[model samples]
Target: MTACVTVLIIGAGCRGKHYSCFAVHFPSRMKVVGVADPHTFARNNLQKIHNIDKKNVFNDWKAATERERFADAVVIATPDRLHKAPAIAFANKGYHILLEKPMAVTPEDCKEIASACKANNVMLAVCHVLRYYPASLKIKELLDAGAIGDICHIQHLEPIGFWHFAHSFVRGNWRNEAETTFSLLAKSCHDIDLINFWMGDKRCLKVSSFGSLSHFTNSHKPKGAASRCLDCSVEQTCPYSAKKIYLKLAEKVVNMEFEGGATAAFTMMAFTERLGTRKTTVYGTKGELFCDGSGPVEVFDFCTREKTVHPTNKSTVIPSQLMGHDGADYYLMDSFISAVAENKPSLIQTGPEATLQTHLLVFEAEKSRKENRVVFVETRKEHFP
Candidate 1:
């Protein structure tokens, strides 16, 4: 019989929804036994959507971990600030962890979680999903094959769509810098990881970044605009009106599963209701990749002096037509499962190498922002070792 790992899901939000989808897709290897969330509505919605045993659901992660009811592993998908407590609680009990990124809001908290997981001899995989994408994997392969030839400076930008930025950073959970780190930590961590992955063991020499609420402040608010998009006078004219772009996309976007046995549509709706845009770009010496969450994957290769557009592969069960960023979701989940089954570290993300690299970027960026000087990534001993 194939050994099945029973999994517990923490947090009933967006990431959790995706993880639940993963559980459903790979039931032979993993089983989602229980789910917990502080918000009753979110938890109930997940339970109903996944048809989870009501008795197995809990309002608190601590309670679920204590009982050891339904899992050998726990997926932590809570907000940036809430990661440490549940992660540590379950790790101490010997539960393997799939932790969502930014790891934690602070470097100290990140260290704590890393230390706890290490002490318990549990596998701690951070959800830097982009590392799992096929395009990124292909990029890594090309880089390994010397496609880029000794990487030089990289220029990466996350085109956080205007409306998406407003919804998440300005009015949503990430709006306050204190709650989450800067937009770099909250939004660009994936890019940082990808840069590190492509940099191929090269330490980031220096880091300097400049960004602010440049487009979403009171000064930029349109005339007669209300605080929320629903009531804004410019709703019809605004490109990011919640109802126009995000809500419409939410309904049309493909549905997937996540950690807490929640559905993707539920979380998408929440994001649209809360924040309204998404787009990210990563540039390298050899090539550049761009994803707008609603289009084909585009790559510009300097070596070949050509551009390649990889259209969405739509024949799969999930219907690639609805898949975002050329079905990155499918590719990422498939890679993670393959890595676990093969008992090997992932090449793109989810390993100490990639995690440390990105965290170093975050650390230096925060330092640079505070000191108003460029900061460099310093090579350090592996946190896990």
Candidate 2:
């Protein structure tokens, strides 16, 4: 805890590598001491890059947990369904945890993981990386300073682009809810968490969500369309053709809706032609705040009838490998490692209790979608206790 925080990389997939890269980029603050993945290729690849010791390398997370705690923390980036067991196991082993998003597949599992961390007195930082963005922090600061004059309504959108949807949802590991989790949790938890974060203390009393696999179902499949885009006669015309999406042969179209608010909040997530863009607008009594996920925060003050812009403070020195999601990934990893090194859970914004609450909001939205009814969210003082 005094020096660099030693971290065990679990899963060693895309997310695992992204989080582990922080150690590579900032060796003095963090170090990758071990890695575990069922796939030998993945484990070995990360091992070679991090020079992980052979004695500490593991075939699976359970094996890593079998040994006494050697690292100060563990980054659990395993698939959605596999989160609970490994998280609880590692927490019991006394390793502070940096769990990937959608803390677990179910509310019960998320609660249990949070409880385990609390009981063991270990820090738990969920990967709600959006909150770590400079824009996000600035927006929060402005809101806290009454720049927006008390958020009355918020509208946030996640445009997962048609190709991105097809790639990650239609044919990827997240394609089946039974295999992983629902689309909302798989793709939009970060959006939901951000909305919840901007809402500040205004508890979400009720939520109603509606979404479906309407366009992706077999019923919507074009006639004579082959199972694979390569074999399809209409590959050139099919908007979702893998060739078109992966190769960027076509432009994107996005779905959008906007309504002006300080108390009410809405989140729209879609896999349309809109490439991975996010737009957020928070309406307050005195002013309005807007961000397009890549641009500066725009604020319009009603009192002065003037507008001001706050540009994002980009981190240029960090290598692209250590950055993603508008450079929030690097900051998120740095914050979590700082928290683990200092044994101060509060150092991270997405601590167990805060993440648990936002995740509950997501779960409720999903329930509302499934049941086709408005679901009331439960307010909690502390999720762990």
Candidate 3:
């Protein structure tokens, strides 16, 4: 059956457009028929690109959803705090939802969103993109085939590049937990989701985490250095200079090193070691699997004493060849579309219940860190649609 999945993009931010991009390639499978964003310029730009009708564009998601109930799905990429209302409203209005991760920023809100999805009988796919990556799929396949045997423990690292952390968590949109959420939920929720994905039905029962903003606080400010990079005398020596990131990114665009405009801009942030990092390792009864966002997926078998690598040269950090976070974004949308087409509960592994469990674990990790004790997670009763 044809997809004909019409999407209402609730937020016109880069992340929203990233998934909305699916329509550009598989126009027949899905398309953004409407967009709801407060930014007129963003709505206008999307309209210009996808040719959505003026009547379908609105300054608010609530108003748009109220006015139109025919869209097949709604992609809620709104800010961390603004997710629940729109998601609940749309689900009640009979729209399947593709939501961003850290579901609703708080445990209560996460529960509410999951409850609403269940109550309304709508498919709620939290955008845990890592679960959809080809490398992740391969790892899952390996584990299922008993290449890694039964699980043991997992070691995961989110090397939030220094500048990346500063840009997003210190000086950027998610810097203040009061406004958004903690670094764990805002950035690493999906990361932990990937860990859960590999762990298979084995839940992360006990967790104790340790992390902090040790490097970006006001005390860390270099003496005599101005607040902004441009005004700082030691801007050149500053490891996390804004000038370096944008300039290099602009140059890549000029040189045509990146094909998609958004993908190129994404590379601008990712290619720099100015300080972003994510690496994960899964240990099982038989072997281990290692993978990082910037590089290859590696597998080691203790029984055979063998190891193998795929998709790149050795275990080194590899530049993204195309957009969608090494194609995870595209695969995520593709899976969602398949789910819609087949009217199945889900096409991929993680959904509302699983994603909610993952987000809660991050919360548990934070709690463990704060209280200085190990935390245990109870078995989650709710499952996803």
Candidate 4:
């Protein structure tokens, strides 16, 4: 375990390259020994950067799994639908796994992946990178220390800027639910996970959600709009014109009522101007916390009638390429590498069980949205196997 933890990259896409770059930053702690990506450019890109041998490079995950395990762990950064098979296959091969979020498209597939890792005695860490952020960690610490007393309610808003939504959800890889999954699972699963994390052990009892592909559908397409934004004559003035970043629009809202009467309402939007911020408000018995997802967290203590600002960690030097999610991407891989190097799963806050718990929450929320009714949360004792 003390030796460098070598990783095999599956799907050399943005996330695949992002996690593997941790080896570049801390070569002594980790190493990238192999990669599996269908694209020749992506595969060669990783090969040139990591000096991976030709034999270790694969056209796809199936080819990688066909060989005996060559690394300590495998990073499953495949698309949402492609996650299940490789995750289960690698886990069966006894490779610790760093799976991307929303483990799979379906709850059954997610459970099966978790079961495979558990049966093989291989560790699984889902990429819930939000939990690794300094700001998020600071929030968790203050809540755990009872800085705000018993939690009563939380209002969380993720204003995914117009450009971001158009690029990723409207025109990019995650556009269609048929291809990937719903916006809730594809985009905001981690946000729900963070809220559940702040709730600590308080189980979510009832969940109700309301949202849809309201504005992003064909019905909203403006007159004279062409299928391709560049070809459209009205592209310049149309809000959703692929050529221009549109205005901000609220996409969905998920409301969860936890066991202890604590409620959380999460609002996710895509049409708003680029806010680049997660606005959060936590109201507790004794006080409240207000955070703009950066700088300092403000806590208002009712007893003292005073507001105190707690500054978050800001000294970590993040590389420009891997600065996604406020440099949280670096810390997530760092924790995963350390856990693998030390043979300790405890270091990973987003392990299979923890992620599965919140993933189920997300599924339920989505279910509630689609069914147009409240959904009661369910937990199974044998979730792993």
* Candidate 3 lDDT by residue in tens digits, 1-385: 6658999998998888778878877778988899989998987888878999988988988788667486888899998899999988998898989998768877888888888888999998988887777676777777778777776656655555656665776678986888888777777666667666766666455666655556566788888889778888988887778877567530011000111111000111222453434565767778888877645678898988898886632223322321556566766787898887679875856677888877877777778767777666665763222
Q: Between prediction 2 and prediction 4, which has the larger TM-score?
A: 4
Clashes of 3: 5
Displacement of the residue 329 alpha carbon in candidate 1, Å: 3.2
Which residue runs of candidate 3 sit more than 4 Å off their true CA positions?
A: 248-277, 292-297, 308-322, 382-385
The per-model lDDT (C-alpha) reads 0.63, 0.81, 0.72, 0.87
Name model 1 segments beyond 4 Å from true.
Answer: 68-70, 223-237, 240-326, 338-348, 382-385
In the range 1-385, model 1's lDDT, one tens digit per residue, is: 5466667779988778776676666678667778899999989887877678988898988788667435667778888889889888888888777888878877767777878876877677887876666556655565566544444444333445556665676667887887676766777677667666655655555566444345556787789988777888799888768777578751111111212221111011222333222343544557766544444656778878888776543335653322544466666555555555555444325754457556766766657756766654455564333
* TM-score, one value per model: 0.77, 0.93, 0.86, 0.95
How big is the positional error of residue 117 in model 2, measured in Å on the Cα after superposition?
0.5
What TM-score does model 4 achieve against the real structure? 0.95
For residues 1-385, what per-residue lDDT tens digits would candidate 4 score against the true structure?
A: 3789999999899899988888888889889999999999999999999999999988977888888889999999999999999999999999999999889989899889877888899989898888898778888899999998999999999999877887888788987789989989988998999998999999888999998777877787787888887789887787666556433334899999998799999999887775558888999999999898774889999999999999998646887766888888888888888898898899998987888888888888889988999998875464445
At residue 153, what lDDT does model 2 achieve? 72
Q: Which candidate is the best by lDDT?
A: 4
- Each candidate: RMSD: 8.7, 3.4, 8.7, 2.3
